[model samples]
Target: MGSLFEELEAREATARKRVEALEAEVAEVSGRLSAAREGLERLRIARETVAEVLAEMTPEKPGVAVDTDRSSAVDSVASAYAGAERHVIGVLTVPNWQPGMGAEVLPRVYRDILEVVTDARGPVRAKQIVPRIGLPAEAGKIEGTRSKLKRLVERGWLDEDTPGMFTPARRRGGASPNSR
Candidate 1:
């Protein structure tokens, strides 16, 4: 009976030591998990702070004035279509006129006209472009808008499906023919 009692005491001691070691391991793992979670939370907060700061800052201005001019041309064309009593049948082709000479003389007007034309459903004729693109009424006398459309077609901005009918080149994935 005395030996049996001693054996029971030794077994209890062994069990207690194992339980203590397991408890220590559990505590170490729990500490590591908590530290990792805190690090993740800090990173999330940093990202949100950066986003908020950027939102508070003023947006970057356009690099070139020519881009604004092209945008204005697009606006003018849209406005013209909006006010027209006639259903918009086609796009307008503005003359290749730049305000100044030099490297600034990019044919942006053709691209702008193509953008507006492609936004429409039907073919756009040259006569329709004069008033819409902010061109002078006298533009009608300058070999007519037909010649301007032909010029655009030659540049690949406008496609002449027939003699007088014109359409914009098909665009895909936010890219246009002249975007590159």
Candidate 2:
């Protein structure tokens, strides 16, 4: 009986040691996992910063000189593309039945629209703008949005570099046409 009691004591000691070792291993693994997560977060932030810098560094189309008067328009376009990448798309809303109001009102709406487009990260279509600005979805069906976008291009608030690809003017001074 004494020998049996001794054996049981030895077994309990071994089991306790095993539990302690397992606890230590668990703590080490948890620390490693936390470190890895922190590293991943840092990488994600770095990637986003790099992407924004690259986008800003990219130049507009070659052989097309952007008008100096359209500097605000160009800035708006770049801002929009960057904003879109960050997932903050806004709409340009105008009061109903106020088209004939005044030049002041017109500039306000244009500024609002420009703000939305400039802050977006990608090319925003007229259809998307209507919904974002709190206008009826049918605004796209009407000729109004289309005409407004065209006017924006004419006024140098937006630039239609290609048939469907609209970008801001190249007045903010990042890359030159020769570099693109």
Candidate 3:
């Protein structure tokens, strides 16, 4: 009986040590995951910044090649391709609204946002629009949504009459171009 008790105690100690090792591993993995997510977010922001800068500098003519000295020609080519197939593909930033432009030309998140504002039929705030677009009603998400709304306003896809309140930009026909 004494020997059996000692064996059981030894087994329990081994199991506890394994659990502690697993816990340590989980902590290490969680830290790595957080770092990876942060790096990914930084990359996303860098990409968006580059896209915005390129869009501003790019000429409307298709034959004009972007200056490859400042940036990769592949990005310019991809942007041109994206512009050509924008109605079918998603763009990283909102394009300058054209007369016949529709919500389909925008990315899925932007389209969802536009739809939410149009459906609201009045000015809506970022917090109000966030959950409607299937985002969690968190401060970070609300701020991100707000930034997107401001981008839409800048691109003439939406309007902000009051600070923090967004509405679809009005067309000559009293309907939003996004409605089409």
Give the per-residue Cα lDDT of candidate 3 at 61: 55
> Candidate 3 residues 59-176, lDDT tens each?
5656224442334545555655666642211223466677777889787889999999999967999999999989889898798799888879877799887899988787666444
Please report the candidate that would top lDDT against the real structure.
Answer: 3
Candidate 3 residue runs with Cα over 4 Å from true position: 57-93, 134-144, 173-180
The window of 10 residues in a row where model 2 has the poorest summed lDDT is 88-97
Which lDDT tens digits does candidate 2 get at residues 98-156? 21333343445455566667777977777766666666778423244555565566544
TM-scores, all models, native as reference: 0.33, 0.34, 0.67
lDDT of 1 by residue, 117-151 (tens): 77767887666665566666564322345664665
Quantify all predictions' global Cα lDDT against the true fold: 0.53, 0.54, 0.75
Question: Between prediction 1 and prediction 3, which has the larger lDDT?
Answer: 3
Between candidates 1 and 2, the one scoring higher on TM-score is 2
- Candidate 1 has a TM-score of 0.33
Q: Can you give the lDDT of residue 24 in candidate 2?
A: 100
Alpha-carbon runs more than 4 Å astray in model 2: 1-106, 139-142, 172-180
- Cα-based lDDT at residue 16, candidate 1: 100
